[model samples]
Target: MSLTLAARTQHMTSSAIREILKLTERPGVLSLAGGLPSPDSFPLDALAQASERVWRTQGAQAMQYANSEGLMPLRDWIARRVSLPHWQVEPEQVLVTTGSQQGLDLLGKVLLDPGSEVLVEQPTYLGALQAFSAYEPAYRPWLADAQGPDPQALQPRNAMNESVRAAYLVPSFQNPTGHAIDADRRAAIAAALRAHRVTLIEDNPYGELWYDAPPPAPIAASAPHQTVYLGSLSKVLAPGLRIGYVVTPPDEAPGALALRARLLQAKQASDLHTPGFNQRLVLQLLADGFDLDAHVVSVRQRYKAQRDAMAQALTRHLPEGCIWQIPQGGMFFWVQGPDGFDAAASLPDAVEQGVAYVPGSAFYVDATLASRQQMRLSFVTLSVAQIHDAVVRLAEHLRREGRRSC
Candidate 1:
């Protein structure tokens, strides 16, 4: 018998990065495609010890089902850690999710409706687009530049046109583009959101991965009442643990109570709760003085060197007129090839030459705005030597393709 599918299935699409990763798995292919954190950065020893302690000390309880809102201690830790001088987060507002990806899904479930207008950057995180698309919201491109999204777009066209349900941003070391919004621009964006009375979803998974310096205080700090903040330990701690949290608006904020309730209900429906053993393992690590801050510092230093290597290689090997910037932090570099280049079309040849990267067009919500010449190259996963080699292969592919274009 034939089976019927839900209408939402039409909006769902496979992740371009995940699909590319499968091809990059071929023998001898050096990937600059996936934004995978280096395995070397994981605190293996500390995690092993933490896992043992959880199994030894709290074996039964850790294995059982847990609170849907997350363990209180972990939530408390998140609340204190994310709290700023001007704005403080409360434990009640923190909802620990299986991963920040789950937080995105939960928010989309509660906040979006069919045809709801949602503002997204021209080239935002593809994963966010994937998560939110399931809820079937109409996407409007939030025009941006090197600085960040334009504040003027936040303004409503007329008083009656306040139909924009929410705006999503990755203010610190944004995925795909590696663009970080400066402090002044963040404040301006916050002001616009406040004035327009629009809700903001601020996803900040790479805030602590900064190489030069920590990114500016979160945009949520400036407009706490109008923003839903999502943070994750995957980048800083361990992704396998799948630990992440969402900070909802304060009680006094409009619709705060109802929004939080729906989010909690959505969480319950999704997975009942994140793994209790993982939560306990994190607490055990902290209690044992794992020194996460120090670990993150070391991670930053190692990634910075890798970033430098990628920068040097790109400069030396890429064709003239190809453009990219030295990112201050994060895993990937967004590079635009010279005129007459098509990054997506060149991927098969690049992979055949033993290198791979993600075409930047996958990140755009609107096909017309997507650039055919751009690709995202990840630097954190490969060693310095491998990075240089990968760039050489990629540059050779570009040159060979350019000869054909001429």
Candidate 2:
């Protein structure tokens, strides 16, 4: 007889990106698949020096179990860094998380009631959808246009069975699409959330990787009382450190205070705390005078070159009917092929031909509405030459499928 399983266990599924990364490891394959930061950009020297300092001066303390709310100094630093001139975020408002991913899990646990509505972009971050699915919230797509998801449409309507609990978005350098919400849209979205009284989960892991000017201030700045802001060190520093923070609204609001307390309880249940050593190591890194801004400048330079190469390669190699909007910043190129070209179904052929990308369908809440012709390709993991060659190979394969002219 088969062993019994919890009903909630059925909700979990493997990450498609992780499954695809395994295929990418086969010999001779060039993958534009994983949304990973370039290893070449990691500040190894700074990390090592910081680790050594953590061991040398605060050895015992670093190994000791930390608080569920995270290290005070680390939280303080994050609060100050994210605070804008108009919006002041105090250390009491910050909670250090295992990663921004954990912050998503914690938010879902504390905020969502099964069947509650959660508004999302047309093609949102797949990880977020995965994280929130365990809580079983109903997703309603925020209608999007040339500018971005319209704020007015995101407001509550007579159609929903239940009240909208929250709206989640990657407003800066959005995952999959790589589209940053402009300042005007940010204000409009913030206003709408306030008007409708729906909470906002502002996930922004890629905001700092901007190739040109910084994206606008977070939507949280506009509707401070209504947003749960998330930020991560993974893209800017190193993913192995696995450090991120969640900023709840100011403490003066009792609702925000209660939400923060419940979230800490959820976090304590989840991991006790983010590893003590990791927290100290990051603090030590800051104390050692690591210039994060300068480091990010170097990272942006490398990624910009890669982004440029992929844009050029796609323009030169892909068929006439294929289309893509050159991303202004961030890691991916969201490409759309002609009608009748199914990106998800073409995966086996793409893999066999030695090139790989993530089909866009995995990002949508209603998989039926996902564009069959669309795909997301990440450029940071491959060299310029590799990107050029891989696009040529993919274009050749598309030619065989009747997508290319010659």
Candidate 3:
């Protein structure tokens, strides 16, 4: 007899970016694919000191199994860091997860019912779509103009007969797109969510990594009762720690509590708890006067230089009609090619020429959008010199393919 798997498992596919990253491992290939922070920016000495302190001071506690709700001090720190005047979150309202990705999975399990309608950006975060898809939500595309996503798209419409149970937004330096919703749009989205009584999941892993001015206040600040704010230490501190927190609404409606409870249950099932040692280590670091703001300033300088390099490379190399926005923050640059060129179709050629990028279609909800001529390039991983050479090679490849004229 043949082995069988769940029906839901059948539709899932491997991440295209992961596959391309593998190809990029070939010696001499310049990869603009992975969303990786510079290794040089990590506070290795500080982390080592924190880890040592954790073992020496809290050794027993670090090794023991802890509560599913997470370490109290860590939760307290997160609550303090993320709180706003409009949304004063308490430690109890925070649920710690292995990473923000786990938060996404737990939210999907708790809130999404099969076939329920959820609104998402036209090209949303692929990882989010993957996390939510396991629960089988019917994704309704949220429309966007140059300014960013319009909140009206989530409104309950007589024409579509759809009521959005929830809408997910990155709001600040969104993945793949690297575009943030402006302040006005943030308020509009919050108002719409409140008016329609829809839940909002605000995932903000990259908010603190801004190179220029900070993005707008979170949508949660505007509609605290209706938003679930997810924050992470991955980009700012270290991803290996896998520490993230969720700030549920202040009202703590039955739905919100139920979702939190279910998510905690899911956490218990997944890992019994986020590792105790890591939590204590982070807490120790915070207590030790590790200035996150100053550290991030250094990080911002490195990334800003990279962003500038990528922008200049694109301007000098890319063919006419190709366009991209120079993001003020975040790690990605979303590029759109000429109308008839598909990034995926051109990937083999790009790789052969010693450069790699993620096809934009990987980030889209609809498979038809895969054919659209777009790509997401990461400015964080490659050196400035390599980015310039890669862009020249990529432009040459595109011209050879007749997709563009040099």
Candidate 4:
């Protein structure tokens, strides 16, 4: 007799970044491979103070099981934070998820059928793809330009073949490619979404980490009725907290109301709501005047310096044929190696030279020859001096491989 497993398990693969990270642990290797925020940015002392208050005053409720919708005060704060002058989010519409990653999984669970077509950016967030894969939805590549995915793709030319159930995108400082969707494009996409039958899943984890200015209002802001918005505290706050939320479309609409119930149900089935003590810890911090806006300002300033160091290092070190986009706001610099240079093929040699970066091929659903030429470098986790040194080492390795101009 033999045991069998679900067929969907075949689509699940180990994370490419985690596989590369193991190489960084070796002696003297510099990693620009992880999109981790500097630990220096966290307000540990303030958090300690908040934790003390939570334990002393609210320990019972904080440790007790909570409602699936989450703590009321936390939900109220999230609703107010996400609301704009034109659009208002109700507290009941906010579903506290373990992490934004869990929100993606819940959306996949509730909205996707085995064969449903879901539109996604050409090289989208790999985590979202992974979360959606377990449910077995068909992946369709989103056609995009410099600004973002073309608004025209929001509606298929002949959707009669199969309706596109939803489109997923990272509109602000997207992973693997640091391109942010501009205001004009957001409006165009919003207008297109208004005409289309598809729902929009807007996942924005890096919106608050902007270097120059805040990104345009979320695409959901333009068409709140049609978009299910997701946001996270990992970038601005500590990622270890694992706090994130989902803002469902207005409850007044019949479809949105139904979706909200299913989402809450999925969330309850997932973890019975995010850890109550953790939620209380964050609430205590906020109530104690944590000044989240000012905290983000400091984080932006620190990451900006690191971003500058990476930009300068790349210009001074990388071969003439190599190209990279200097991200204005996010943690990554998406670099394209010289013509015919395969980033994955060169990773072993680069690690041997004491440097590492994530190969870009894993980020694409429809990877091609062009995709193999790219890689993503994370500047946030390393110091400015380390970033410059890593770029120099990576360049030396590229030269040795005969992929760089002398």
Candidate 5:
């Protein structure tokens, strides 16, 4: 017998980053591919205490099914934590998701139709591309300047007559680029979106992971009625909890409400709700004064040292013409190899030297063979000493490749 599948599945592909990660799982490779937080940074002991407290107090309530909107107190806490002095958010507008990733999938379900135009950065987040691809939207590459993505890219120009449904951006400490837009450019982008009446999905999981300084206010605060803001506990706390929240528009536009209803329906259809035990455990931690700010401060210090080590190692080992800019915050560094040097083609040689890194082409929605000269190296997972050795191995491989080119 033959089986049939939905047409939408045709465009879907396994995550390239994840596929590469599997290759790096060898015993001796020092992988700088995954954007994972250091295990040393997790508050495991505090979480254990919180779990014990939650089981004692909530007991059976923690095991039962929950409202699709998520735990009320958690929503309220998220609102309070993310809001600014000028920008206020109501708890009613918050929708807790399994993770910010699921939030992206739901947005794709409700906001996109086949052939809908969506604008994205030239080298955008791969996961977002994968999540939205199933909806079959036509993607327009947003132009970028030295600062970041250009706001003018969203305007209705005669060259591109298509109407954009939404533009997705990771403004702070972006995934592969590690570039943050300044406050002025953010305001410009908000104005452009408001002018075009286009919706903006601002994904900001790394905003709180800054090292030297705090990132600018969310663009959602600038244009509350036109933006959907996504936040997560993954970077600052732990990703295993899978707790993330979405702040919907204040006006609760028809589209916003409809989307929320559908998202809740989708959540119920998928998992019935995020694990209630984890929700209660998180709440208990917040209620018991877990000192999240203090925890973040400690994590920031550790990451700063790691970032410094990576910067120093890069200067010591990388071949001529290789370039990278040290990020003020965030986990990864975007590195450009010498002209015509393809990181993908050279991966075997790098691995033979006991080092591993992700080729940058994987991050683009419509990547090409010509884009293989760039790569992304994550500095958060490895210790300072290990990072030094990894860079040395990578440098040795690059030197060998450079001689072949010569």
Candidate 6:
């Protein structure tokens, strides 16, 4: 007998990045494909101490089931940590999620309907597309330039008469592309969203990972009532813990109360709640006076050095006509190989040469329209020496492809 699946299953697809990741696991392959933070940055000893304290003091409470809204103290901490001077986030509006990915899924469940129009960057976060796709929304690619996604696209214009349910953005050190929206553009985006009364989903997993200076205040600061902000500790802390949060708009905002209630119901239906043990563990660490600010500073220094190494290697080894900009922060370097290069088709050869990178097409909503020459290379996980070696292998692969085309 054959089992029938839901219609939505047709839209569900495995992440191309993950599929490529499996290929890179072969021995001796130096992968530049994953957005993995360096293990050295994790405060192992501090976490160990915190774990012991939690087990000794509140093991039973930690093991027991938690409320759907998450631990109150942890929620309070998140609210305070993310709250800006202009935009104040309250604990009551916070929903702790398994990860920011779940926040995306939950938002998709509560906000999107089949055929709903959702604005997205031309090449946005692939995981988000994966999550939103399950809801079967019609994606409208937002116009963008070198500064990042254009704000004017948020306005309703020719051929776009339907109301946009929501617009998703990664304004700070976005995935696949290391572009960050500058201050002026962010303010303009906020204004456009407010003027058009469009809801904004701002996912900021890498805002705290800056090297030179912090990014501008989130667009939410200016339009707090119109934005649902998602944050994650995966990049700055350990991803294994899977701690992330969703900050809903203020209760006073339009439909904010109903939105919050529906999101909580979605969370309850998704998983009774995120693990209580992980929430307590994070609280325990904070209670122990772990200086997160100082820890973040240290991480920035290490990653900046790695970024520099990757920049130098690319400049020295890449074939003529290859293009990339040294990212100010974040893990990946978005690279475009010379004309006639097909990054997707060249992956097997690159992996064979002992290096691997994610093809840029994977990040675009319409892969058919994506640039064949672009690829994303992550620099955070590897050492300076390993970075150089990976670049050498990738450059060799590109040069070989170029010669073959000639």
After superposition, the stretches of candidate 4 with alpha carbons farther than 4 Å from their true spots are 159-162, 403-406
Q: For residues 26-118, could you state the per-residue lDDT of candidate 6 as single tens digits?
A: 999999998889999999999999999999999999899999999999999999999888888999999999999999999999999999889
Worst 10 residues of 6 by lDDT: 154-163
Candidate with top TM-score is 1
Candidate 5 lDDT tens digits, 268-299: 87777777888898989988889999999999
True lDDT of residue 273, candidate 4: 79
Kindly indicate the candidate among 5 and 6 with the higher lDDT. Answer: 6
Q: Report each candidate's C-alpha RMSD, comma-separated, in the order given.
A: 0.8, 1.9, 2.0, 1.6, 1.7, 1.2
RMSD of 5: 1.7
CA-RMSD of model 4: 1.6
TM-score of each: 0.99, 0.96, 0.95, 0.97, 0.97, 0.98
**Model 3 clash tally, residue pairs:** 0
382 Cα displacement, candidate 1 (Å): 0.3
On residues 3-92, what C-alpha lDDT tens digit does candidate 1 reach at each position? 999999999999999999999999999999998888999999999999999999999999999999999999999999999999899999
- lDDT (10s digit) by residue, model 4, range 200-276: 99999998889987899999889888899999999899999999999999876549989998998888888887999
Q: What does candidate 3's lDDT look like per residue over 1-406, in tens digits? A: 9999999885566778778989999988888888877777889999999999989989998999999999888888888888877767899889999999899988888888989888988788888888898889999888888788887887788876567888899999999888989998898888988888889999998888788899989998888888999988889888899998888876455477776777788888888999999898888998999998889888899999989998999999987768888998999999988767778888987888888889899888877755467899898877888889888887776676563532
Candidate 1 lDDT: 0.94
**Lowest lDDT 10-mer window, candidate 5?**
363-372
Give lDDT per model, in order. 0.94, 0.89, 0.86, 0.89, 0.87, 0.92
Regions more than 4 Å wrong, model 5:
158-162, 252-254, 368-370
State the TM-score for model 3. 0.95
Q: Note the residue pairs that clash in candidate 2.
A: none
Q: Compare the candidates by lDDT and give the number of the best one.
A: 1
Off by over 4 Å in 3: 158-162, 252-254, 369-371, 403-406
Tell me which of candidates 2 and 3 scores higher on TM-score: 2
